[model samples]
Target: MRKPTSEKNQSEIAYEVLRQKLLNREFAPGARIRYGPLGDEIGMSATPVREAIGRLASEGLIELVPQLGAVVKRPTLRDTTELYEMREAIEPYAAAKASQLISARQLKSLQSTIDTMKKLHDAMTAGKKQGQDIAVRFDKSDLKFHQTIMNAVNNQRMLTVIGDFHLLTEIIGAARHSYSIEVLEMTIADHTAIFEGLTSRDPEMTRKAMTVHIQNSRELTLSRLQDECPQ
Candidate 1:
């Protein structure tokens, strides 16, 4: 029993390490994830590595093929469109629900993330730091802000679905978008509007703000994908 538990722990560790690699685009979209080499690289054995790969496949982060093994999932433009569609459907509702129930503590935490992002945006604009330098940090705060709202609902299933969408978008967008200053500014503005709505505790306002933000994100992401992968 202890040995099995140990293996499970190791597999979980492998899953997280590989998932972060995927999120970081260390494994590019469509890149083969060779099990043996990956295990060796992570200082783990094949069994645990295989288990971890299976978990990622279940999460739609990778695809398992018969002869080719596991490969990082490469979301197409259609996939991106569908993903944003789902987000648009769910997130605004989440924002509306969250506006009614979010605690002052959560609101404060969200505000802190926004403040950090604002500083990053200001720094980028003033040429104190490169946009890319702060891009990943800004993205982290962005994730936290949304996750905080979703978590407030106390619905595990909704959180899981929305979390998956967030992960997919981050992975795919990192593979494609440049995260330019203009993009960051647009994102900051959208987040500010959403934050204001949340602070106002106005459900309708929050919903509308969230809807607009998701719509802008869809357009920006789809445009970037089309530009880079023009056929």
Candidate 2:
């Protein structure tokens, strides 16, 4: 399906808007989300709001808490482990296959996004943004990097099944402990390696690079959590 220029109804617009905010950390994990209140927040009514929340809930972004209505989901460490495990199995394959099948046009599109990432990184460095906020700015690029790899592979089944994991990883990135400046720099390095692998279109190297990327990020995330919760 093609991206739409305009929403056909209020619910469609509402879902996209809310989903973006959720993904971007406008709504934090365990955030209490009231349907009627959300409608007011988004300048809509309960009906459309309910529909939007339902759509997100289906995607594991929010969960119905019985007595508490819909709450933004907080993933466990196990959730992160399981999620990265799946990405390990699928994303590397996606990257490998994409390397084999990625057309010149697809590579061009990816390079374009890579250029955007360069600009985004420059803006961050110029502004000297600090702390958790850095992740907020670059997390979109992180999502783009992964999504572009999937697009390059051009596999529909990979897109459909791995797509959820793509979003889940973003949530993990956003909702997990904020990365230190060191972690952020390390992330950029890992992404560069993944891009190089894809550009070379080497299946084995690409899979190894992506798996290493996931493991490093996972360890960094868990390390941050350990410092915070001490569990």
Most accurate candidate by TM-score: 1
User: Where does model 2 exceed 4 Å of error?
Assistant: 1-8, 112-127, 227-231
The lDDT per prediction is 0.85, 0.74
State the lDDT of candidate 2 residue by residue for 1-231, as single tens digits: 986434237788788888788667887777888878777887777787788888889988789898998888777777777787888888877887777877777677666666665665665667766646666667776777777788776677788678778667667666563555566667777877877777897888888888888888778776655543322
Q: Could you say which candidate leads in lDDT?
A: 1
Error of 2 at 178 (Å): 3.1
Model 1 agreement with the true structure over 1-231: per-residue lDDT tens digits: 354557888899899899777666577778899888988998879899999999999988899987999998877888889899999999999999998889999999998988998888788878888655576677788889999999888889999899889889887777653467788888888988988988899999999999999999999888888855433
Q: TM per model?
A: 0.90, 0.83
